[model samples]
Target: MRMMKMTVYFDNNATTPLKDGVKKAMAEALEVYGNPSSVHACGREARLLQDMARRNVAAMFGVRSEQVIFTSSGTEANNLVLRGYFACPENLEKGSKLVISSVEHNCVHKTAVDLNRLNGVSMHMVTVDRNGIIDIDDLKLTLEKGNVGLVSIMHGNNETGVIQPLDKIVALCKEYGVRVHTDAVQTAGKVALSFKDMGVDFMTVSFHKLGGPKGIGAVIMKADIDMECHTSGGSQERNRRAGTENIIGIAGAGACTEEWQVSVDKMQNQIGPLRNKLEKGLKQLSNELYIIGESTNRVPNTTNVIVPGLEGETAVMSLDMAGFCVSTGSACSSGRVEPSRVILAHGIPADEALCALRISLGWQTTEAEVDAFLAAFGEMLGRMQKAS
Candidate 1:
């Protein structure tokens, strides 16, 4: 009789499985079944739950409860920040200008482009080095141009896991009187984030990225910064965002954040050893293979490697068939057979970018899973070598 193998998942950067505590919290909230905005006993109960969640999220970032505005997802939170900032009455008079890093996620890049096309906002690109770290000199030069309203840079690269120099960038922007926004979706729960200390004008985070339920996220904004409402009609999210509050999802997000705070130290210690083991095993198989963003400081759980002479999609499919799930790049554009823009921006050849695969670890991942992945990956590389 043939034996069936168990599947192993290594793509936590793309999305994480919901934590048990988060699920339980959401389930408890679901039983309330009341609109938080309505004025009644049930509504009051729902509103209290929402407020508690807000406080929890705020506490995570060392900000006031009023500063965290809930949104549907990280994408929406990002859009809200961009649109809200540009639409501000004071900024509207001077015409808005946007400066963003070349390696930012598509949501940020596309929004900047849209602002340029529709609102006559000027868009500038901040180049990054081969290590995927943004050039502070380039950012300063771009910000030096007067009339720069906002700078949007990511706290970390979603594909390469490279962390941007936020402290330096923020200081430069402050010197130029330009507001800064960071997409912290990748770094939020993975790292210890304090908005009050970070001092960015705005930062975006998503619950799904950190073992919480999907379709819920928040934007942490500085109290004094003025932002126009992107969604209108209701008095939800302190009039920052409209539509009904996602009470269940918000409850889950709070619970998830609380749990993360408890386990962050352990997670930090565990992921480094696992990543080193995986990288060492991969390197042993072939020295020709290279790790992208290896020269820069990066998140512990991620490793983006380029396998010599093999298409990333082919390798990803082969691993999938072997019961090991991984990704070529951003899961958003995974199906397309194109080189990753993040890789290309790092000055890697387009063909070489096509050979890159990203393997990420998670809190739930085990040592046995890593060992199994290494064994399977070695076998797959051998097969590819023979076939070539």
Candidate 2:
């Protein structure tokens, strides 16, 4: 039973392929080699390109250009938000406490731990239900305890694609005079997101997740928030994230975000149907198979399936051999064999969490690709079951 080698990427949650617009933008930016921080003519040209990218990103996220701080990656952006706010002497004196949802991305989760371990920032985790929705009551209870400086919750889970009740979470945090930060790395381009509407004090987004080049991410903050810079050196990014701007990556990010509304529309109208089709096919293959966030409101492009008695790593490798790409969990934690902590946070058994598979679609994902992936996945499961 030999399977043909055909590439069908279902790992959009990990990273997406670069679009033509992004490639064109990056290609043009490569020729602008001037340092944006310099005052010379070449410098001004580079600065112009970088500023255009900032404005495009700001417009896409519905924020002012000045409020977006560019960082090396989503990990750096998350670190900046956590360390910048909590490291300030006044903030640390007022409240050294930080609260975060249990299902946050590794960048957020790991940074909070590091802050607590090294900086004495008291960390509290708000629990989530089996469907990966945050426990609102648990969050409220944590807030009531007081001395909480910030609450960082992701807009959407990277593994489950479960959208948190951010509006409610923000409102509660505001009542307690606590600032809120959401890692919108997974939600920003896949759905209609508004920084003003969500009302969170800060948000983070990664460009690679939106079909842009890697090594670029942004932190969207309110103009009035007095946060310190984590990467201190020259006065770049308005002295917030001090480093030479990644002009090329920024150009790609800018191009990807220019048509944000179009991307959202396609995800809703076109990609969502294909995702539903994929889930249906998965279910029909095995009665024991179940999706993690099926009934809950999730991002339109992701599906987290748990196949009973099958290791997620094994499924991923088996599918890879057939040229279908999928994932067991976040790309950050890909090589680890342990069950997903995010999935375990949902109260799923550890054994079942190990059986999880994440299939994330994108605007480029077509019906034929979805069908091919489904066929390949079904074949892998058949072979596994027969051997067992």
Q: Estimate each model's TM-score.
A: 0.96, 0.96
| Model 2 steric clash pairs | none
Cα error of candidate 2 at position 254, Å: 0.9
Residue by residue across 1-388, what tens digits does model 1's lDDT show? Answer: 9757448878888888899989899989989899999899999999999999988899888999999999999999999999888988797565477999999999999999999999888899989899999888888887767778889999988898999989999988888888889999988877888887887999999988889988999999988877889877888888899899999999999998886675566457887688888999999989799998887888878899998688898898999999987998623356657788889999999888989999988888888989999999999989988988
Candidate 1 Cα misplacement greater than 4 A, ranges: 1-6, 330-336
CA lDDT scores, all candidates in order: 0.88, 0.90
Where does candidate 1 have its weakest 10-residue lDDT segment?
A: 329-338
lDDT of 2 by residue, 304-384 (tens): 999878989889889888888889962334665788889888888888888989999987899999888888888888898
